[model samples]
Target: MGQLLKWLAGMLILASLACLALASWTYARSEAYLRSFERPPPFQLPIPDDEVTRARGDHLVRTRGCRGCHGDDLNGQFMWGAASAPGLPQLARGSPADFEAALRHGIGADGRALYSMPSMGFLRLRDADVAAIIAYLRSEPVIDRELPRRSLPWAIRWDLARGRDMAMPAVMNRVPPLRLEGEDSPLSRGEYFAMTTCNECHGLTLQGDSAFGDEAAPSLAVVAGYDEKAFEQLLRTGKALGDRELPRMSRVARRRFATMTDAEIDDLYAFLRQWPARTTD
Candidate 1:
């Protein structure tokens, strides 16, 4: 009986050591990734108090869905277990340039390519609109709200370790190419709205993804299943198709898009409905 007790004790020690090793590995790996992050350019928005610019900026903020993740006050919020969004961080402290790069390139302020920021969608935004968004964010009053630090989930780490996903490289890649020409056109306007706002989660292609940072999210292209009225309803009311529980999108749409003008919604719809094929310029 004494010998059996010793064996059990030995097994427990081994299990404890394994757990310690795993914890150490996870901490070390995450730190390494964080350390490797490159700092994006400093924040700078060109527009100041120009009423036209501010109005445009407001339109940009509302239409591009900035208020979705960032709170209504632009203070920032945390959301867990959603279909499309992963754990989002508060950007109040992030510089305007950091925000711009994040919006335009999907690179975080730390310079590591953001696997999460939907830069692809924002890539199509007009320079003026992008500048306007930076302007709006700059004018927002800084509200102090502490957010829990976020990390990659264990399942994602496993996937990364097993080579199931691509590691974010240490370089700034342009967001998915956009169809907007240098001039103001219908397609360009629509593209601008989609890139800056919708693309934050939707792939640059708006193809939609199930996995952002190792969690299960839904796809937006599935909107192919929704009619325009239903789509508008989903965006404005946070209701899913047939008013089912939409979880993530509902919160975002209600918070960010509920105030969007019908014209803006129509433009966004036209862009989304004819996406990929029409916008792959």
Candidate 2:
């Protein structure tokens, strides 16, 4: 019996050592990918001075989660203010083209691949809208804040080493090209709104994801179940049909979608209601 117990203990130790070795390999390989991130060429957005465009751009920034990473000001912040994550660079001082590259491509000014910026979420932004975002960023107050060097935990690195969690630059490359849907129709406008904003957490197709971070977001087709009033309430308040306060979506709703104009809400609803049919077809 004593000999059997010693054998079991030995096996456990071997397993633990194997796990540690795998984790170390994962950390090193993922770090290599990040260190070798390619730099995108200079691409400029024509910064506009028009109030209407600037306002729309500002709205996009809020809804699309610029303020979530960058602070309420346009200046930099630590990634979710977590010490391990890289600090964000001050966006206000960056040229419009550099900002566009970082926003859309996940390539930084220093040419390193970003780990958490999620540029995939912003790659679908329209040309004019991109210009507007640049214009708005340029107009914001610049705050000079330096963040600590970024590092990832072993768990995240393991996921990165495996195929489960991809880097933002790779994810950005996988996104479908955005159709330049002119804003003449509600369907077009709503599709734009949903694709850009919902796609951040929802999958790129707005099909919702079972593995979105830790949450199983329902398919956006579920939006079809909501009447305009209920839908508006959900977006504006982040409460579900049962009045359950969502953890992520709720906070996002309060910060961004709550201020959506009635017309924009109407258009977004119109598009979402008709979305399931299009996805099926």
Please provide, for model 2 over 1-281, each residue's C-alpha lDDT reduced to its tens digit, 9 standing for 90 to 100: 99999999999999999988987788778877776667666665556788888797788888887777667675656654332232233453456666777788887666667667767778778778888877666666655566666666667777877767776787776666544365578888888787778887888777875223457666788887789998999889989767879877788888989988898899899998988787766
Candidate models: Cα lDDT each: 0.62, 0.74
Clashes of 1: 13
Q: What is the TM-score of each candidate against the true structure?
A: 0.66, 0.78
- For all predictions, the C-alpha RMSD in Å is 5.3, 5.0
Q: Which stretches of candidate 2 lie above 4 Å from their native place?
A: 1-28, 35-41, 80-89, 154-164, 178-183, 210-212
lDDT (Cα, tens digit) per residue for candidate 1, span 1-281: 99999999999999999999987786566545645545545545554657777677777777666556655666666655321232222352345576666666566666655554444556556667766765655566765666666556676555554446543432224355555657576556666676666765665445664223343345556767889899889888989888976757788787778888888778777766776565454
Tell me, by TM-score, which candidate is best: 2
